[model samples]
Target: MKIILILVLFNLQSGSEVITAEFDDARACDLAALRTFQGVTAEPDMRPLDPAEGASAIEGTVIAHDSDGAEIGMYSCNPSRSDRREG
Candidate 1:
């Protein structure tokens, strides 16, 4: 039981990642370039769209890291285009 508990705790304290939306054209381009971070830059997998699509959105992943590099949380980044407009 002790070993099982330890394993469970270890799994709970791990770093994780998430897919998010980023509409920043410039930032999107930078991420798309994948040149600045030695290929660590994640690319946005555009969601499929249809004629009925209301707005265009880009999907990006967010990597959440724990203190010791242990994935603790994972989530998506849906960065609204407001920041881009401000810049």
Candidate 2:
């Protein structure tokens, strides 16, 4: 069995932010990431998880670019823990 792990990175003023999540498949993960990105960008008070926290979050490939073509954020999905069976 395979599991989808999504990792999202956000470039912030203070520092880079990272978000990690798990889904059943790539499509689901990407869709969720897109919605989350829109919501986070729309809300000022919403802050992304710190790098350390993101690392802990058991984790697509969508990248957000600026007008100048600078990558501001990214979403990556990959397989994780295929060998570990769920109890």
Candidate 1 global CA lDDT score: 0.31
Model 1 vs truth, CA RMSD: 15.6
Winning candidate number (TM-score): 2
Lowest summed lDDT window (length 10), candidate 1: 1-10
lDDT scores of the candidates, listed in order: 0.31, 0.57
lDDT of 1 by residue, 1-87 (tens): 000000011133354333233334545533432332223323322222232357633344333334345433222334343434532
Per residue, candidate 2 scores C-alpha lDDT tens digits across 2-72 of: 45645455656778776777777767876776676656454223223345543643232445654454555
